[model samples]
Target: MAESNKNGATARLRNYFLAGVLITAPISITFWLTWRVITFIDDRITPIIPPQWNPESYLPFGVPGLGLIVALVALTLIGFLAAGYLGRVTMRIGERIVARVPVIRSVYSWTKQVFETVLSQSSAAFREVVLIEYPRPGCWAVGFITGTTVGEVQRLTAATVYNVFVPATPNPTTGFLLFVPKEDVHHLDLTVEEGIKLVISGGIVVPDQANFEGAEVDAAAKAQVAAQSDRAENVEGNGRKRRRRKQTQEPRSPGFITRLRNYFFAGILVTAPIAITVWLAWEFVAFVDGTVTPYIPAPWNPETYLPFSIPGLGVVIVVLGLIMIGFLTAGFVGRSLVSASERLLARMPVIRSLYSAVKQIFETVLKEQSRAFREVILFEYPRKNCWALGFITGPAEGGIQELTPDDTVNVFLPTTPNPTSGFLLFLPRRETQILSMTVEEGIKMVVSGGIVTPPDREVGDAAEPEESTPAPLAKSG
Candidate 1:
């Protein structure tokens, strides 16, 4: 009991620390960045301000923090002005004048496009969350439907669909933009914000499944039938004996030490990759500084001017630095370095084994694989007689397909409550069933482990799934 209390106290302290970070970090960082940007702009534009008439000169306290206030007020006024016709005309005229400047025009135009996209309410830049198969088969991913397909590709394909962006794991801001057929792209019943939460959590923090009324009702109906059947069976005496046998064979939870050890291992799994990457980067930098800096050529030497060290000598150093370490690691020279490093490592057996094992694990996990994009399919998973979540990534490749006779498709039966980890099963298309809910709804059901389902009235309708983009599947379909 005493040990348990000590652990609980430590946990509470950690929780409070995390909570403090969650509440205060954003505001503090936002203010610091805003201050720095304001300072930079003030320094750049300071000379433009007339010396005698400067706002700072006239103020008694030297107009403390004036630049930030000015920037904020100017931005707010510009926003207000842009909302009106006359302001827009004035702004357009100013923009036209600014655009005439050669170097500044490109920067100004790019900034305008970014700002307009972020500020304008009508922009459909990131409107919907979608579940699209990416990277490999047996793995389905969450992506944002940025907008309906446009640009040259759409015109070429004659597609009426949109662009779905599958952001990389742990970083939803960067991912591939796939142009999927409208029919193939399944919209989620999740808000864009909620979908973001799900993706960021990597499927751990899932939306409640109870949100789907239809799925719940269907489950309850099935349960009622199952209960009635069980009652009838129990009356036959065989059921009691079967129950006794099954109860005796039930599995047990892991021992405390086993659970604790697994938890520690999981922590190492998450951090080891990042730690190795940082170590490699540091080693590369140190090696470059040690080996290359001496050969950089003495500043005052006669050959330094290349015909005299050469003009743009600084630029040459920068270029050499960029390529030197990279080239060293790629060819014969790189292999020589690796061999030497290994010899040094071998001198320390314990450290060598630990480093080698960690490096191998990182390499395996980080290596790019071609298996991410597999054939899409529909399947009912996680429950019996009740079809819920599915994945379309179960198709076999050339050699694999030839081995199977039945038209097989790969469907990953994702474990509900956590969709990230699941079983990849080869299922037949004919045996697989279609679902009334959209792809997003299915994911929600899976993430919630069948706790959420479509509303009852719509569940029975195979023809139409009400399409007002479902609330985030993560929130319970």
Candidate 2:
């Protein structure tokens, strides 16, 4: 009897502990998320807020929630204004302008839908929570019934469909809007609020649902990694037992170690590019300051007047000096002087070759009309049917065109990971394929080894031909 009493006490203690945890966790998470949101808004909105309008400007110490409060008021005010006649007309005009832009139109429409679904409290918006397969078969997700399909969509898909919005976990703002068939949808017993809560909690904190029995739906859904075994499971038809090949247990949340690793990688992703860019910029400025600062005229230098040294003074001086040189070089006297200098340099053997090469490189690069490495083309290389990316430097004139054919064209086939060095091929014009990708995009693909790709464009809808006025590489002596 004493042993039984002790066991009962132990069980009660465990229940009490669990109940305390159940109460504490949600409250703690809610407060943490709230703080995070407030700070994030403050960081962004604080800078843009005028000193006169911002209350923190008057205070000695910075206030945190000022920006958040401002943001709330601004959004509410905007909403109120949007409902007015003038604001509505302005919005419609703005939308019309946005709709004219092909890419922006798609993005705007999608963004508008997300806002409407999440914020709208109308009868047609998120009427009820539902269950549907998403991403792939057997992978079920909790969704909200945004609306029923209409017009083109209903006509195109020969079935009764509902516009189901499956909100991503941890963030209900952005997610997939699936046009799910009505037959596939399982009307969950949970409310819309419960569904949203389920998503925000990352499938944790599941509400007790009486739609489906335990151990049966898990086997049928063929559950995946996500902790979706319980909440995302669909109801069985007519309470029939499903014949199952596999009976897997509910997937658990990621362990502490996994979460730690993910956080570490995420931190690296955010910091790496910023840290590298800052370091590189600093190094470049320091190099210029060390090499060129001493030579700069005292009057021209800003550091001479300032009490504290400026970081990018050398860079500013260099840019101004280049602009001045360019202006001087455009004059008739400058041209005569340059011609005389070139004639003198042409008398040398090695010096002439180097100077000629450098000058030609600069001229070609600087000239807007010179389409050197401007056009992206494709041609067979090494073997037939095997293609390669090449830039059209110019026409295959001189001996190469004479020896081959009148239709021959010069192509520079760039290598992967390094576009500095490449093979030069002279092929027939008919054999080459002109691609829609620009030279910049081609270089990017080459540098990244095909990791980054340019979006596909229709062949017939390609831009104008690569050649710009007076054919390329036909330079006058």
Candidate 3:
């Protein structure tokens, strides 16, 4: 009896300890990460201040978050300078000088454009969340409406089309671009941030009930689906068909082994995402630190004087260095030097070709006005029956369009799971089937290998015949 009582107390203690760990671990890690970031920023930025001007120099102890405040102020000052007419003139002259260089021109131009687009508040990069049907009908995906098709693409298509960017799950930076008709896409009520979260979580973090219900396709699409379903039912006698009832498994008390397995799986599901996120962040910081820390002068380096290594000092240095470079490059003297350096690189045979190609691609995509990944599309590929998810890059112009008699569109067919690499198909516009799913949904489907499907709607409800009232005829008589 005493042994049994002792065992029960031990079990209770174990459960309490587990519960405490679950509660405290996340909070502890979060605080630790925040402290590390603050410390890193302080280490790099604090040294820049002269001893007389520094708060730490007079204070009994060092203050946290002072470096972050300093960094913000520095960025604001830079922005204020860039906004002026003199700054604008200086920037243009620098750009012209950089453009004169062959190899460096490519890298600098691309980097500058990317930074500008990202930093620009006016840029509509990923605002409108949309839905698109991907792979085939009955399957849908979420995506973002990037913009409308422009240049050669607009001229070729009879219908007004939109550009959709379908980003892949876990890492949404990569995905397909599809050109879909404006009428076909189902717009979602979810915001851009919410959509990103959904993509990263692999559909586990869905929106609220109200938001989910509000995500409806166009009324015309509903009618069309209903009509199609009606036709299908008519062709294959509805009377002969019966709905298959799904069997529900009976609930039973779990055995010890079963309970243990369930608990283990639950623990994994809870911890894995947090662990992976932290690991990725840590590795990124480490990488930046590794690359930049070695370059720091021994006298200026924090690690040289300190007993322990600082975590994000290199990251802070790298950011400040980039900003300083940008500031310098905006001036006349900096541009001339950069241009001279680039001209020397251009003399290299193999490097020039690679540089030019890369530069062109960056300029095309990163330009604020350029609509590159504009639309999500469906095209029959490999064979007639086999359908694939693709992004409409643009109209097939140049030598390729001249070869084909029909009006052709350039479609990038991204492979399942891994969307980074895919086949580029030049298909006739008439042969392509435009879908209604958004790029976000499309990416989720691709990442999950068709496991994560969009919400189902009843298609044939409107098509069903209603019973006529016989009383109305009698009343008229």
Top-TM-score candidate index:
3
Relative to the unseen true structure, what is the C-alpha lDDT of residue 434 in candidate 3, on a scale of 0 to 100?
Answer: 56
The Cα error of candidate 2 at residue 276, in Å, is 3.6
lDDT, candidate 1, at 228: 47
lDDT for each residue of candidate 2 in 1-477, tens digit (9 for 90 to 100): 999999999999999999999999989989999999999989978999988988778888999798877765565555456556886697778767867976445434433433333343333446567676664556667876655544323333436656555566797755544456554556666767887889999978688856322212343443321224232333222122242222224436778765555444433333333344456567899999888899988897777898998888788878988998879889998888889999999999999999999999788866999877778876655344223468888788888888997598878876544567667889898887776677765665444333233445653323321110110110000
What is the per-residue lDDT of model 3 for residues 361-423, given as tens digits with 9 covering 90 to 100? 787667887645555665654433333467776788999999987999887777545766888
lDDT of 1 by residue, 1-477 (tens): 999999999999999999999999989989999888877867645546677857776666555455555554444544445546886687678667866877445434433333334333444455666664443433567766544443222333334545455555576654444455553444556667887878788887676653222122244654654454355545645666777787789856778765545444433332333344445545666665555555665774345455633334444566876698878788998899988998999799699999899886566445575222222234333222212234555356586678877787766665433456666776667766544345554554333222222333322333322221211112113
Off by over 4 Å in 2: 1-249, 283-287, 304-308, 459-477
Looking at model 1, residue 421 earns an lDDT score of: 65
Q: Give the worst 10-residue stretch by lDDT in candidate 3.
A: 468-477
Best-to-worst order by lDDT is 3, 2, 1
TM-score of each: 0.35, 0.43, 0.45
Say what the RMSD of model 1 is: 21.1
